[model samples]
Target chain A: MRLEPIANPGLARSAGLPAAAIALTVVVASLLALLAGADPLATLGLILKGAAGSKFALLETLNRATPLIFTGLAVAVAFRAKLWNIGAEAQLYAGALLTVLVGTQLGLPGPVALPLMALAAILAGALTLLGPVLLKTRLGVDEVVTTLLLNFIMLLFISMLLEGPLKDPLGMGWPKSEALPRDARLPRIVDGLRLHWGFGLALICALGTWVIQTRTTLGYEIRATGLNLQGARFAGIPVNAVMVKTALISGGLAALAGFSEVAGLKGNLTLDISPGFGYTGIIVAMLAMLNPLGVVVSAIFVAGIFVGADSMSRAAEVPTYIADILLATALLFMVLAIMLTRFRVVRG
Target chain B: MDLIDILLSASFWAAVIRIASPLIFATMGELICERAGVLNLGIEGIMVAGAFAGWVAVYAGLPLWWGVAVAMLVGMAFGLVHGVLTVPFGLSQHVVGLGITMLATAAAYYAYRIALPEVTTPPRIEPFQPLDMGWLTDIPVVGQALFGQTALTYLALLVALATGLVLYRTPLGLALRAAGENPSAVEAQGLSVTGIRIGAVVVGSGLMAVGGAFLTMSAFSSFFFEMVNGRGWICIALVVFGAWAPGKAVLGALLFAGFDALQIRLQQTGLGAVVPYQVFLMVPYILSILALVLMSRRAEVPAALMTPYNRGER
Candidate 1:
């Protein structure tokens, strides 16, 4: 008997695969939990309970999920167009820097300043990818290398900014920029909870992304370009333009992640603010099967896992990194399941 | 002190070579792997896993060489996972490679927690001693830098030389290159492209692991979280800068290490106060990007670089 990938699968089969993959992830993670001397069932229950068992916990989960929604949507759009924008991490930082500078310097009222901050963030994020995209289009430079390299460079630039010009005088030797004034802060959605209008903004972005991908001519061109670059070019799809547009949109979305963190959560920019939220977006996008609407679900699920893991570590004495293991394993299984959609497994 | 004083110092040169050793080992491996058609983004995690494994070995009272062996084995095992998914399943290389990195990195972190839970200061082991070649180490700037270095530094040079011989001078190397450029063509010639690619990945990852181990076993003597610190990614860039050649890759690693050493020295000498030290830290990454842009147009990348092969399919 031999196994091979099946061609031309239907939607039902595709839908079933991710469910099976999540089940597989649960099993593998259980084995890990067992090895770590914890009861798998209890650990799983604790995780779910920690993330959504109470109103406060659920609020925290959604708060944690807000940035991921933006980042995940960013990744989904880029991957859909076959543009590997690994610089989301850098782009996010770029957005944050721009947002901070604009918000702090402009000193406009809330109505005027918030919109300006968002625009600066989105534009700065998109602009960061311009050099890499242009290089890829013009000279055949690999975007993966350039984008990944930019992440390091942008991070150092952020460090330079914080320690040099941006450092707050009253900050007492901490490496952080000055906090945004009340007019610049995101209006909190729920009083006493960390949830803010950024949560609403994330949902809107996700819905907007879904509409763009499904209903727009640009979406069709992007889909065609990703499916077959040569064929798209042959069909007069303007493949390069599609790639550049996708990069811009993806980079802009990633910047929103940065914006949310600074405006809603942190209130001031620090070197340690992100904690690799941008990179986690790639996993979320993949787990969502690169679908825009699904990005919301996956982002929330991932954020829940992370938040729950921290709680589990404190309450159950489980290692915090156990969450990382489960997430990584889930990522692998999800991809394997997704790829399985391309080919049916048949035994001969 | 002026620029000449720093440039002329034996210790500065020594610092460059010492700092570059890990990159040299990793770049050779990365060059070989890429030449064989698989882009292993798992390099970062593999290096971290290697560092952890080596540290554990030394902590367990094993010799330094034993620790290196264990680290290489861990790397090869991770490579095997990458090979199985990408080679046979025909999965996307980028996703699978990234997944493997995440898995390995998580595993390394978990292992570290289990082994040394909640230590305020990280544990240290006996690091490899410098092999001072008496008369050889006395020659101005080149002497102490080249001759009075750790044995692993010397081994890194040997690995580079051996990689060159294996890649350019051997028939197996030709088959490996052929497998990357055109796997179907290699299969047509009755060589198992799968076998060649898998072997190359396993060996290449093993070498990368050794590079990681060198950081813990020789350079620092302690395994801290994120000690690899994007060195593996830098090695990936260096491979592009080197145009996939082992010899040129050596130069790339040295250039990166030179910047790193210079920055550390400048910071120590209070000269870095004029500009934020981050400016110097940014130099290596920025230079690599510039190198990528300049050389990429002419780079002869293997044709089938990121594609998974399925028999009877185009």
Candidate 2:
């Protein structure tokens, strides 16, 4: 009998691959820019200027990054616990719809109304998560399928609201909800700044997520179960409970993002309230290598791409879809590069 | 309400077939892919791609069938890319799947703007003609309901039965099932996991493209941006509702289609004018969630689904 022994030198390989992935994404994206008939160097400059060159630009970037922060954290949290919840977009809509119902229909005072709306958002989001969670836990349904399916339902619900019940009667037939009252809106963090208190909330949430992920007992159990559910079960962890708990927390965080978008940026509910922020969060979380602090940087980077892409569209006459292609291409490049961390590549 | 009278009408049946056509096509494709363990998330993108390509081909003066052929070819090409990326390149399934979606969406949007710049009414071909069975039309309810659907509707039902038989009673089906359930185990037994997956991807995406073509050739004679409108995702759910089988998925599609038809009917009725339109419009999605919640007990996910396979590794 011939035995082939496994030679596992792991730490060195893992340590080197993440940086390699980032570099690969940049290089591949530069090549793609050439194909799109734009100079990569010039495009990068425009992106920088658009994202951070001026106070206004930087403010916009941060404003855009705010919801991404919460959603990136949401995806990262559920992913860390080994659940694939692809329904964040739907959860965001659920949150937004609930916030509208609470904030607009009830007609309460500002301070009290805002908190009530936030609570409603969180509750709606968490409730939406319960179906997938319970189906996975009790009925052996795959959460991936259940959650992905729910996304359509949520979007359709939004369409229903916007096109019918929630349409602003004052807007002359626009498919949008009534705008929140002046008191219901969040104050800008500074004069002439697009930044709102949502940015602060995002920052605080990031810090809170970092601490919860690293310092708490729940984190330990969640992390252990993520590594191997059966092993965690053997180690006396209640795996199913952890999965459900983490999923609800994730959904709640994502919903909070919806609140931020509605209350912080857009006062009125619109069909396109999310410019795919929830979906973008998936790539951001994965690119961050699932680190809480890393998610902040990755979110900012993604926000820059979105912000800069518009400038490039204006300046170079390049379509914004080019930027979309670049962003998606870079994500694929990153995923491919990351695969090298676990598996060695050989030409043989 | 006169909802029952509206439901009993011939137009209501036409609406049901129209709504169900794309879903039947998509769910069938998803059924094949899931059976083989690939879980083609690219169906959303592929459907969008097909919608664009089919419309473009039609606008370019090609026959509708030719447009469909080109769409299927394009879908197959996309499947090839998806298969190679995950199976050979060993990328994350979800990541590659998402990439395909984004790529297809961007491509469709770009192409739509380029091709249909001035056409406000949208570029349309003559839609597929409804097939009226001569004798079957004599039966009041069943005839109007089942016998007067377009060719694609009947074709969708045929695809369902054919897929069902193939999936359950063929050697290829057995091999694909083995690949999905336990690739490494299958590979140990001298099967080609990559080959099986690639084959599944091609066939599945091709089916999804037909679903897309159904959108143009039967439901509407034109294509628009994001026109699949989350139906691909709905098909993904339908796969679950069908227990990853073809026959049940068609049933699920028809069930949802019935609700959609009723919703449209309600939208046209006097009662609909009195009530909020949102409640009527939300019927399909709300029904989808209800279906999910109700059928949560019957989920039987494939064991090896979504897991990237390695050649002979533990």
Candidate 3:
């Protein structure tokens, strides 16, 4: 069988394929649930109810999705330029570390400290990614491996600092940073709601990313560079410069996830601030087809599965890892579905 | 002990070989995949699956060798998923590989939870025992280090040798190399490029699974989450460090394992009190990045490494 590219796919074919992919994922999930000796339909129903059945659950999902949105945007932006920045996990840690340092040491007023904390976080994340991007552009190294290796390195660096200089004195033996003061903490989105302003910031970032991708010259250059490097170079786009710029933006965006998790949610930095949000961001970006606007929906969707699955695992006696398996299957099937939208398979 | 004493000790050298064993199997696995023009980023996840599958198989009363075979079969199954998507569907190898990794890892974890729902501590099994060469074992540091390891370690060395021999000395190897280097040429020769590439990935993935099995069945007696921890990624770097040659790749693994063993020993020395242990743990990853940068300019990557080939496409 050979796949032939379709000149133009109709809207129904494009949309229908993704819908079919989701259905396939549901089928896979059902089979897994059956194998685990649970009522498949009830398990799925419980997941759906647990995700958005109550205001608290919905709020929980929004809180979980805040970091994912940032990381998803980061991945989407970087992947658009073909930079393949897989070190968002490292960059997130850098941001969190810087946020904690600024929050604990600066002793500034709330209005002044919060923005400063964000700025520091962005700078740290950007700097973290800059090393790998520079290596890729200058040394012809693969950013995928370099960035990935940095994740382990950054984790160890964080562990060292936490155990040594950054160790919290007031709290007995825990390897955690000092709590961010009330002033440094992020305000809630609403007075009575459980959600924080981080969710709002994530939305704003998603919108800003959309604008940058659609209405800006840098965005055009990024798409051009990703599509064809030599062609973009011949067309007078500064390919290397664009890649570096994309890295800065992507890294900075991913770092915001750390900043938000530290300041908005946890009010302190811990080793486990992210439950693989950086990695999950890749799934979000791909599920959204790398579209900036679509990241919000995908992030929320991914977060809902995790949140729902966590609760479902408690009530249903199933492992919470079902969330991961579901999302992974969704990502694979979705990519294949997206491919099929533009191509038709035919026996040669 | 001081640095020199640690270096001279047979235990340290044995530790190096033990650490290098998994890397050897995985590196050779990755080498074959890349040589056939598929990146197989699913290696990390596949290794995780292999580790879990092998341990669980043993825990379920299968023989140790049978556990190893089970791991290989599971690894190949994942590989087939990777191969089908990247080779035939022509999806982005990067996305598909990561997806596979996530899927395999999640499935393994889920299976573990289902299999041992109430167990807090990961259950341990009897692991591979070291071979005794009675007189050889008495011969000093070199003898014990070389001959005292479990059978899996020896198998790792033998696999590396076989990989070198098969890749450089066989027609099948030539076809696999051509699939990566010049697919059109292989197609012109009437050989199935798709078949050769997929076959390489399947076989290579089986070896990678064995690497993971070594962790459970030899290096450690129990399976744990995060056991495979970036070893698969490091193997990818080792491939570049070795310039895609099997012999050099095995050497790269040994060199890395040497650094690893030295760091573990250093953590117990006087210097361990001054420098944090995390810093020592950081050495191998930092070395991998450095190795990539150092070899980047000189290393000749397979020409069609990440590109997907469509029939009749220029």
Q: Name the top DockQ candidate.
A: 3
lDDT of 3 by residue, A1-348 (tens): 778999999999999999999999999999989978899999999899889999999999999999999999999999998889888999999999999999999789888999999999999999999999999999999999999999999999999999889999976999999999998999998998989999999999999999999899999999999999999999999999999999999999999999999999998888999989999999999999999989999999999999999999999978999999999999999999999999998876
Clashes of each: 3, 0, 0
Can you give the lDDT of residue A149 in candidate 3? 93
Count clashing residue pairs in model 2.
0
What level of docking quality does candidate 3 show? high
The CAPRI-style docking tier of model 1 reads medium
CA shift of B142, model 3, Å: 1.2
Q: For candidate 1, lDDT tens digit of each residue in B1-314?
A: 75667788899999999999999999988888889898988888899899989889989999889999999999999998888777766677777777777788889888787777678798899999999788998998899998899888999999999999988899999999988899989989988877888888899889889999999999998988878878888898899889888989999889878877887788756677677788878877888888888888888888989887776667
Q: fnat, candidate 1?
A: 0.66
Query: Can you give the lDDT of residue B252 in candidate 2?
Result: 91
Candidates 1 and 3 compared by DockQ, better number: 3
For A159-271, candidate 1 gives per-residue lDDT tens digits of 99998899998999998999999878898886777689999999999999999999999999989988889999999999889889998999999999999899988888999
- The runs of at least 3 residues in candidate 1 whose Cα sits more than 4 Å from the true structure, single-residue gaps closed, are A1-16, A345-348, B268-271
lDDT of 2 by residue, B117-218 (tens): 456778678877877789997687667668887877888788888888887898878888888888877777787888888888888888788888888777
Candidates, ranked, lDDT: 3, 1, 2
lDDT of 1 at A96: 92
Candidate 3, which segments miss by more than 4 Å at Cα?
Answer: none
